[model samples]
Target chain A: MDTAQVFGALNIIGLFVFAVSGALTALRNDMDIFGVAMIAFVTGVGGGTIRDVLLGSFPVWWIAAPSAVFICLAGAVAATLAQPLIASRLKTLIWADAMGLSVFAVLGAQAALAAEAPAVIAIFMGAVTATFGGVVRDVLLNEPPLILKQDIYATAALIGAGVYVGLMALGLGISPSAVVAALVTFAIRAVAIIFNIPSPKFARPRKTEL
Target chain B: MDTAQVFGALNIIGLFVFAVSGALTALRNDMDIFGVAMIAFVTGVGGGTIRDVLLGSFPVWWIAAPSAVFICLAGAVAATLAQPLIASRLKTLIWADAMGLSVFAVLGAQAALAAEAPAVIAIFMGAVTATFGGVVRDVLLNEPPLILKQDIYATAALIGAGVYVGLMALGLGISPSAVVAALVTFAIRAVAIIFNIPSPKFARPRKTEL
Candidate 1:
């Protein structure tokens, strides 16, 4: 497939995975079905939409295609319906979420470039598009953003987008470049999760320090 | 004053008001001092900064000037120290917030216009900038966004921005148009609050509905 086709397919997959991530978080947070769906939609698409607007691509993704909305709704409903059984498998969901995050980082930069964004902007947009929605979701749920807390989330996106843009600048064909970028990101995040890579530790405060 | 100057003044007043509004909300929620300060800072300036970045203004407000951060911190400290006494006088804080919201709408539109945004985009930015941060604060605290539930919040911003843009398009001076817009918005909101204006009632479920 060509670059456009590769990016499009990956983007859809990222959206679905992103929705699943949001639904999982919502489930853990004890949100209702509607609440889960709303969180899912926002988590899956909010960052990309923000990036697009910043880049002046209006009508936004969900507005441009109702299918994304429909799919996100279905995912949330499925999560709610499966909660009784699925809660036992949160480990699996986290890995899936990491994969989703990686895909989004790669796809985001590609989309920005296709939309004619500058290279540095494309990389930043990629990271923001991949990760900030989860931050929003976490903040709304009263959790510190995923970026601030745990394993290599925003950094993974940043590196992945940077690599993709760098490769493109080096005149590599877009499809191979995208595949390498997505795979590298996915490997990094998936290995981190699967092998239980520890996040950088915050300094421990003594009880009397405060 | 030019459009930029009008927005600059409104921004200063808005900084104080929004900080107070956020700190007061945090106080009512019984957050600790640090939590209160954080909420105050984010709610005071977060929305407009987000709007500005999405509109391609870099460094955002807090990053551009450290003073805005100090103002929010001071507001938080003031609210924290005074909450025991101020709790009984909640309406005062509410009125102050309403005033801030009105001015934020005017300033939001003016900022967008100064950035040379299209009129329609400016109006949208006005609504988003005035209403989004509070919405973020409410959602983070797990409350329904005020615009989704109560008085005419986003609607008021839209109306004011529309009026301002209309006047300015007719070659009216910026400050005069902005002042008129802000005054009209503040009056509408103040009157509505005094009269206890509400959104249209949701259809109540009958005895058999459940």
Candidate 2:
């Protein structure tokens, strides 16, 4: 298979994991079937949708390829069926989610670079692609988004995307650069998960007029 | 001078109103100055950005016209300065927000029609353009989105966009249709606000296995 196809496969895997994470959230909230499906679809495709829209790519990725939609649906259904096991194994789910985040961040940067976006924009797109799905899901669930929570998630995406672009500019081939970037991202996230990295939050003002 | 410019001016007014609404929300939450600015910016432009991206319109509107950005910033600053008066005059703010909703809904439909989208997509884009900005602001503030709360807000945008598209399809001129549609939307939203309309919510599932 071509390099693009290989990356596409990786992304689909990431999409499935994200969908599962969304479904699990819905289940935790005791949402109805429609809510479960809606959350699944949004979490799986939300970041990519945002990325495509920002890039001005037409029809969005899932609308262009319905199989992606089906995959997300299937993932949600599977999570529903395996809820007991999933709830008990939250740690495993986080690891899988980290892997998905790594793949998505690299792919997002690659898509932006292909579109001839500036490096800074490409990196921002990468972080958006890796994180915005969860943000949307969290907002819908009335939880503070994971991006804003004390976590090292979004920063890892930025670093990975930056590394990939930098490697490409240094004359690395596409395949090698992408693989290395994804691995580096996964490593950073994995370390954060293991050591429990805390996000730096902006402090609230001490005084209120009211 | 032209039809588009006239509509563009109307949209800027709408943007200003949305920014003010966002700033008010930030003040109500006792957020800091940075939070107030961020909320104002998102509330003014988030909906239109989503619409443009979905329509495959590149560069985003504000990127193309820095004046819109300036308008939102100015509105936010003004709202911050006028917070005490704003907090006291909640009723007036609701009226202003309804006016913005009307104008944005019509403008969104007009933009979609100009892009040669199908009527259904055009109407959907209009509602999205009017409502999603508020959704983004609420999400950022960790509140239940007003769209999800008991209100006729989204319904007003849908009705307005539908009226505009239907009028245009019947060979009415753009200016007349947009103006009439905006008035219709404003009237519906005004009625809802005065009457305290409630939304029909989906019932939550009965039991959770976990």
Model 2 per-residue lDDT tens digits across residues B101-202: 899999899999999999999999999999988888878767667776638889999999999999999999998898899999999988888888765568
Number of clashing pairs per prediction, in order: 0, 0
DockQ of each: 0.06, 0.13
Q: Against the true structure, candidate 1 has what lDDT?
A: 0.74
lDDT of 2 by residue, A27-87 (tens): 8788999899989989889988888877777778788788888888998998888876654
Off by over 4 Å in 1: A1-45, A50-109, A112-210, B1-5, B87-90, B200-210
Candidate 1 Cα deviation (angstroms), residue A104: 9.1
**What's the C-alpha lDDT at position A121 in model 1?**
89
Per residue, candidate 1 scores C-alpha lDDT tens digits across A53-123 of: 77777545454355776677776766556655543535645665777778888878988999898999899
C-alpha positional error of residue A116 in candidate 2 after TM-score superposition, expressed in Å: 4.2
Q: Which clashing pairs does model 2 show?
A: none
CAPRI grade of model 2: incorrect
When summed lDDT is taken over every stretch of 10 residues in candidate 2 chain A, the lowest stretch is A201-210
User: Candidate 2 — which residues are off by over 4 angstroms?
Assistant: A1-13, A23-42, A49-88, A116-124, A135-210, B1-46, B49-102, B113-125, B136-142, B148-210
Find the number of clashing residue pairs for candidate 2: 0
Question: What range of 10 consecutive residues in model 2 chain B has the weakest lDDT sum?
Answer: B84-93
